[model samples]
Target: MAMFVHLTAAANTPRIRRAGIRADSRGQGGVRGVYCFPVLPSYTLTHQWLRELARFGPKGALSAVHVRLDDAQEVLVGHYRDRAKDAQQWLTAAEAVARVAAQPDPRGWEVVVPRAIGTREVHRIRAVPQVAGWRYLPGAHGTRPCTCFGCRIRGEYGGRRLRERHPHPLDGPPPPVPVLLARIEAAGDPGDPAALRDALHWFGLRRRGPVDRLARLAAHPDPTVRRELVWAVQGWSTPGVAELLDALAEDPHPDVREAVADVRTL
Candidate 1:
């Protein structure tokens, strides 16, 4: 048999002890399964997901449910990123353990058993240190933080401090409307597509700006710049934006037209 551990809320201990770990859909495309890590000789690695899991539930402790499974049992195993369909692979339970053990750093490795683990397969349920594992992603500490709106969750622990510390170039919060307008003007005659895109994105975030000045971009040669303009003009309370959007509705570029269609639906 191969040993593995599943980290879960301590409150679930009684139910898990009675009925075992139930399989649930938690991954992309609703892949239903119990997630676990191979039990290695390293104690820290054996319970590396504890701290990460703690961030989800009500304030409480976490526990490690040790399990035993047949060596020949079929399972899916891969790095965290491999959860994507094209990258995932199937292996025997024993093969999963061996693959993870062979890695120099197994921080993001995981295994998914397609079925529930019956109470008979559980070895023991024990409390683990609340701080046993890396938070966010492995080796994330002491490195530059990604302040993108997608990566930084608002109101999460230390989130405000992190954004204040490492502001992302393009994904960070928008400047005032005047600053964005100055940036657009500085892009000059031919216009820098990237800088214009950045400024237009900032305008989109503000959602209300000088639409008359921005309307001139409808004839920009670059389809991408026009597409950004479409996104920026959505929901603006300013005058002439409706006429501007109607003109863009006839753009020859499919992407720009598609963006205008999307804005209309919003």
Candidate 2:
């Protein structure tokens, strides 16, 4: 936590001052002046110092500060009435401020202090630190563990494990065809590449189900979806499936065409 700083409103109170030198419009714009604030003695503006202050400060007194450090001069501060839940959010703001200050760039940048910090956002900031010349691992430097899609997949399929399989009784309830089809349709519609990939794999195991609805998605905008769809349709003896593969052979994406070629050979 930060060292507690004694703050007072009295104008006569002595305060510590830091000097900042900057250039101006004049030919000799290099002017310098002391900036004074009622901070505790011996406190320096650093990440560790800021973190400590944020840790001890009352939620009511802290807020998420967003600064577009660029020339646009856009600055926003988020103040949720409930500070208890928002303390971490404000700490993120403090960290961003310290990071920007450390950068040597003359141009400004943009950042937001979210009211609720998600794991994805946490992973993003750590993987790509705001300050220049710094690098760290996932969940490094006290950040939470990264469970982003890429990381999760790496964990699931890395090393000797080719894939995850759960064998079921041959006569068990037909693998919820309607539910899987619905999920596949939903994933194909604005089609996130990863979700579609998982859905396609689901199809691989239950290849005997009716796929007329799923096959309609053959013309999906994303070629990745089309490629996986082609893979899922393999081994079906239906003429419709063959037609689908034949049409995909002419897909604009070379990879999709290549997938169709491979499936044809099989």
Candidate 3:
């Protein structure tokens, strides 16, 4: 019986047989004349239509909907079993994703999606919607709404277990530098390295920022945070930043000292 299901799936599974679709991590698609956009794996139709499409006839084709987010460099993907199956349910779901992508300031969305394709696998996008007025909220980076199928499954696993498994918030936007710094300070013993890492990254994104407050963190006991500070201070020649780097050069950790000395020698 299991063999029968496996044998039948080959014919009914909506396999993408390489109609010339490619994408890099930066959401650049269409290496060939065929235009494509990045697809979010969780929204793909494979899971939704696996059983239904398999039970249908063998001539069905899989359809993919790619919604280009307002970032232009970002995209959301949705998949369907067949474009014309079950009163167009697959297409409806795909269009719903596009509508959400068009909304103003969508919140609690997944920044990273499940990866469904590999170098050996061929994935194709059949539809690209012209969505507009979509918003990207930086403050909402770490929160994913429970509506998504992936989130539903996760919810079944319970919150405490999930929190234990993933110490860092998996969904949501990058927090402001000040908020990140506050998180680091509040983290206390058995420190939250992730918070410190994010704080450093946030600091690096700005050309000018709170040098004094960040300078105070130079005294943080964690060598990792101090090392990140060293990296972030590079290129800035301000006296405070320079003095901080000099102090870091005397760090007990070899890695921290090395990072402080690694000023752009190029």
Per-model CA lDDT versus the true structure: 0.85, 0.41, 0.43
* Candidate 3 lDDT tens digits, 125-170: 3431212112122242366523322332332325435544444343
lDDT of 1 by residue, 185-261 (tens): 99985588898988998888664789888887888889999999988888788888889999999999999999999
In candidate 2, what are the lDDT values of residues 1-266, reduced to their tens digit?
Answer: 11111221222122111111111111111212111111122223222222222223332232111112222222222221223433312223344444345545312222332222222221111111123211123114555333332322222323113222322233222247677777766774567777776666666555465667767667888888888888877766655787777888888999999998897887
RMSD of each: 5.0, 18.8, 17.4
Each prediction's TM-score versus the true structure:
0.68, 0.34, 0.32
Collision pairs in model 2: 1-52, 2-52, 2-53, 69-108, 70-108, 70-109
Candidate 1: C-alpha lDDT: 0.85
In candidate 1, which residue ranges exceed 4 Å CA deviation? 26-31, 54-61, 83-88, 177-197, 205-226, 229-257, 260-266
Best by TM-score: 1
Residue 160 C-alpha lDDT in model 2? 18
